[model samples]
Target: MLPPSVFESAFNSSPIGKYLLSPTPEALILAVNDAFLKACSRRREDLLGKSLFVAFPADPDDPASSTNEAELRASFARVLETGTPDLLPVQRYPIPLEGPDGTIAFEERFWSAYSAPVFGPDGAVTCISHTTKDVTEQIRSERALRESENRFRALTTAGQVVYRMNADWTELRELDGRGFLRDTDSPRSFWLQDYIPDDEQARVHAAVGEAIRTGRVFELEHRVRRIDGSDGWALSRAVPICDAHGRVVEWIGAASDITERKAAEEKLRESDRRKDEFLAMLAHELRNPIAPISAAAALLQRMQLDEALVRRTSQIIARQVGHMTALIDDLLDVSRVTRGLVELERVPLDLRDVLQDAVEQVAPLVQARRHTLALELPSQATIVVGDKKRLVQVVANLLNNAAKYTPEGGCLAVRAGAQDGGACVEVSDNGIGMAPELTGRVFDLFAQAERSADRSLGGLGLGLALVKSLVELHGGTVGCESAGLGQGSRFLACLPCLSGDTAPQGEQDDEPMAQAPAALRVLVVDDNVDAAVMLAMLLEASGHEVLVEHGARAALARAHEARPQVFLLDIGLPEMDGKELARRLRAEPATRDALLVAVTGYGQDSDREQIMAAGFDHHLVKPVDMERLEAILAGAA
Candidate 1:
């Protein structure tokens, strides 16, 4: 109802972008608002009296520009024809801009536009008024939000529960509607006690409360009851959501099942505990032997006693040293078996002979304990293919175990027979038997039965473990049984027996000890003065010329001077180790052919291999047996 002049003035001064076009086929532009001129980056003189398409035509080189321009033109034409307003969806329409280099460039833009026809006195359409608003930023924001939601859904779809709770943590629900709460009866109200196990409810509740109070992320691992009435472990984490005023409003959280991982963690903890116990036990057993040896050495150093007292003290020292040596041997044997380094020497042998030898080795212990021994061996020899020495060690270990565990004067029995084409050896004794639980793990490494208060029966707990490993190496099996505590215990070892005639036995030596051959010049090298001097004295007493050196350098210098027929070298020496010294000696022409023998504390198969590789003819562990050394010397001669 306004006048044309007033309406024109209002339309030209509007804040929004607006333009007036003549209702003709050419659609000539008549006027434009200040906002439209600025938006288009043009002047009214450049657009007035020109067709709308001429003023802002599609780019000739742009393929999409024609479609965009056509859509806008159709919208304007519809408004002029129908005399009704037309609203257009958001669309891309590039505008021209002048670059810093004075070149015209197209700038991309998105806009929402509306067009309405203006009528004259006769109600005929005269002009079209168009209004536009730029909406590029709003569209970009909506696209980003949609992408974020898609990513969140992808993550939660794989066995994870995404949930949200009220500010007080009462109204909890699954945001994705994935039925994660179906097990909880889809409760409208949620609490830690409803999902977590009774034992962990309090802890989880306290953590959630703290997170709400401090507005921090809450993370916890606890056991939960699943919908199927089964228990499982779950790791849950949540972050508090706050309002603009920094007030806690709600929390968003996720939970993942971790049952298998938790079980593995428990197993690792148990293994660590067992290892710790084994280390402590090892330390205790080693110290037991060391204490006695140390005391005896200190005693003999300060006092010169009668021959009888000196002999007794020396025996004590020998026994303790032997005990320590056995412990070290067991430790090395276990290491070899674990690494698959041990190999069996299978030879057809008489089981009776093996049993007799084992019995002889354990006779002294049985006598010392005053325990009665009974043997039931088959009159006909039971032949089996096995390593004679290792079999003897196995039987001896079992006999010794029985003697050690049985009280003084207890009864012991050994039964050997052929059954089901296999040979079996059974050793039983009325000892302080083990409990059922103890029997199950009796053969485990570092496993031992309860000991007395004074610990009179002492061992490293490796005897049965070694027995089992050795028996198995020979294609045999070993088992132990006990009725109960204080009843009795029995061990059985079974091996496949030979069906045919046994292998020919070597010639037996029933005569007296052979006289030693003529003594040779021998050189002894060692780092311990006491050990070196004692060995030298022993060789001298055996009618051999001996020279001793405590250092490898001194020994090397002496060996070249003496050109001795035999060289006894210690592996661990200062400045030059025995391996290198041996290499040097073997390289020297003077001592190249000398009988090189390694005499040190090391006795492992690998140690022997190293010594032989270093050019030693023989390797002997420390505290060498006199008879074994005598035989080696005689062989060399």
Candidate 2:
């Protein structure tokens, strides 16, 4: 053994932290090496001769320090009693330091310690030697690594595949060893060949090549094949890992499933295409009726005709005008239904009465087609809560559809009964039945079956759609069934039944004639000269004083001169619109009290409300019915 002075010098200079505690109940610190003094951030003079626990007490502010102090004291007591070394687990033992402000502060630390007994010549424990190693940085690094692994596991569980690849795009491997790709053995050059669909291979390859060449982020959406041999959509993104010299060394990437999102995008595109087709069809249908009306007007003006020819030509004009009006009305009805603006007038009524009216309305078409018609009504009346007019229209549309599609002598049947706690009406026809696929979508707006070049079975494909909307608004449902093309077709409408008293009897009246009222002053104002002239002629022929004006200024001048009792104005005027003209006229005493009627093609509910708000008493849409006009005249008189 070396001399005491030499041993003390060697102990103080040792690199490993060492401290000696006197073999006493208090475990007083006798001496400490320079390494131990540095480890605790203290001077030897401050620690020597003080109790070990008292000199470095457990930090009351740190909960972990108490556990560490207890474990350390147990190891020291065991070493002193048995004269053997006792090792302790790594522990968080914070040391106290005097700050520049003279306040005691704790320096957080983790330590690996071993306590050994130093025996004296008498074979008794004289002192306890404790050795320590500071391992704070190592412990912190291990904790961070554990957290990273947990995050990686979570991402894998969420269906995200993490991949690593060479910077040159020549090799690839899934980081988690989960075979997300179908062909795990394939190289980078052929990686997408087996996974991605053939149609998307070129685009995805190009994107990958560009990203590698420019060291930019790679992003692509492509189709992938699953283990079950099914196809799905995936979105892949990757970033380049570069070396210190800014040279690409590796790439990390992830891919997520996006099949549902892609499907939604495709559906939206299909809807847009269908909307475009419907708009084109609408334009074509409108032109068909306008062409004949234009030619008839030109013929009447250019030629002298016999009375029979004149009457025939007039009838043609009337029929075409009616057709145009029906088309416009259907368009408006669809707009109203789609906007949730259609309000139904619900009333308790007999389903049989509605069926009777609908059958009568379509009798002309049924007779023209020469179809054999059969009617089946229940033994008892079926009562339902519904809108009477709308229910009638729904059944009438179904009957008309049957007549239009059936051959010259096909069979048609309409049945009304009670079923499933509801009143049901069904119309079936042995005509050009629809295909199985079309049965499901026949009631879709603008959905039409195959038609001939002449479009002889003319329609805007809005009838069934309107029926469906109206029926649903009445708290009912409509459905169609077909056996296949040319076999037959059937439509059924069901409305919730109501148990109540009998429906009120409807009034029966003879058709009223368009009789002239006692003569009264009338003014017709329209932007179209022909419309103004035609209206004026009709009013004059009815024995009323009539004047025509083609513009707002002209109509204002005419009203001032004539002081007309009735002022008919178009809503779309040149400099000032009809609403403005009506406003100006209402401000004037001469026309304020006159019966103001707005005549225009704009007939939406909002348009009518606007015109009425502008001081008009009535609003009549274009191609106004003669009977309605006659009634208005009589009412005014």
Candidate 3:
């Protein structure tokens, strides 16, 4: 043991706060070292004769002080009762201090304290020795670290893929994929090659290099290998974890699976691009016919020509008008079919008759192209339950498409036979074929091969779409195949076949000979003066007395005066619309029994329903087929 004087000096100079307390129920303070006095910011007289509770009171205003005081008191009592040493937990104790205004205040502090009992010669407790050290900063640091850990765990649980890597990104230390990718618990040296796609690895490397060079946050959206071994998109971001000198030691990062979002964005972009392309194509196609018609009209008006010249100009106008009408009809047909408006009139039909009709329909085009047309059919008639007209249209459209795409004099073949319990018709052409990509989307609406400025292949890209839709409507399928560009193409159509010869009833062998319409008083009504005059002139040429009027009221007056037996009315009138005009005409006594025909540009199924409901007997779409109109007139007469 040291001398008494040296021990006193050592006790006073010790860094830790030490104090002695009386071993009584009150626990009064008997003595305090210099360190204990300085730690509490008190003078020796303030604590020497005071109880431990009196010198350091638990502040009622501070909730942290309440429980720690009870705990410290229990610890002191235990040490004295057992005559042994005891340790106290970290405590939130408030110390009293003197302010400049001679007022007393409490300063919040934390401490770790220990208590031990002193023994007398009889082995009984006499005094309790107490020691303390300030530990406020250490506790605060621990709390901050725990909070950081909690936040990191929350992020990993909430669908964020967490990862840690070396500063150079050459090795991955750990990863939790959160189910977006595969997890890696051990260090991986080839993480870049394992996670990122081969095509995207270089891009990721560049981003990593930039981030490392500048010690900045790294961010990239690139393709990655998913758990299923498929390439998917991910948005990865990482920030450098630096040392005290701002040198990057490692990188901590997160990634999110963005595969679905990226796919949706790409689809939207493609749709927008297709919409713009379709609109441009529409404008181009419309202008093609309009240009010729406009020129033909100018020629007729500006030049006084001979009979041959006049006839040629009229034919040019008629031809372009017919082309325009065909284009409009195609548009209407596709619209009705796509919207499920067109209902097929199904009947048992022989495939031979359909093929014959289709061939006849395309014979003119075949002849024009000077191509050798080969048609192969089964020895016996192949029967199918389908709409005859629609089937004929399907085959005719395929032939016409082949003709249009094939070079002049190129070979075209149509082969039909029984296959796989159904009938298959393949139309193959030795002409300019399509690329592999085009073959897949050949039947999509507005999908077309690249055309020249002249658009030598004149079509609205609707034929194949119509063919596919019509085939599907009849419970059939259509597909296209091509070797590649310039290698020609083949289109195949499959339809369900019927077993027995169940020919449709009332099937005519041939149409009855057409009769000439008897001369009758006819009144033609139209909003367009030109249309009215043209129809009237044509009717007069057919040996009928024809009267023309531009509107509904005038047509009604003319009908009453002339006692016309037939009335051809345009559906779009000025004051009264065509449907209303037709109703009024039927209500009138003079023309109520007259034949009412709807002649207009509106040709949808709904338009026909409205026209027929309004007392019209017949509906004709314009630039109407005069042969069909004449046949209707002859039948009515």
Reference-based lDDT, each prediction: 0.80, 0.81, 0.81
Give the least accurate 10-residue stretch of model 2, judged by summed lDDT: 148-157
Model 2 TM-score relative to the real fold: 0.67
Count of residue pairs whose backbone atoms collide, per candidate = 0, 0, 0
Give the per-residue lDDT digits (tens) of candidate 3, residues 449-484: 343235667768888889999999889999999998
Q: Per-residue lDDT for 545-611 in model 1, tens only?
A: 9999989889888987888999999999898889999999999999999998899888777678878
How do the residues 1-637 of candidate 2 rate in per-residue lDDT, one tens digit apiece? 7779998998889998988888887889898999988777676656889998899898989888898888887888788767789998888889888653357888888889988888889998888888888888788656654553344322233355778888877777766435554556654553566666788888888998899889999988887765556787766788999999999998898776666556867977967876776777778788988898888888798666888878888888898889888988988888877555656666678888888899999999999889998989787768887667878999999999888888989999999988898889999999989888888888887676243234667777788888888888777899999998888899999988876465744644534455557788998888899888888898888898998888889889888999999888988888788999999999998889988888899887657877899999888899877677777777778
**Ordered list by TM-score, greatest first:** 2, 3, 1
The TM-score of predicted model 3 comes to 0.66
Using TM-score as the yardstick, the better of models 1 and 2 is 2
> RMSD in angstroms, all models?
31.2, 30.7, 32.7
Q: Judged by TM-score relative to the true structure, which candidate is superior, 2 or 3?
A: 2
TM-scores for the candidates: 0.65, 0.67, 0.66
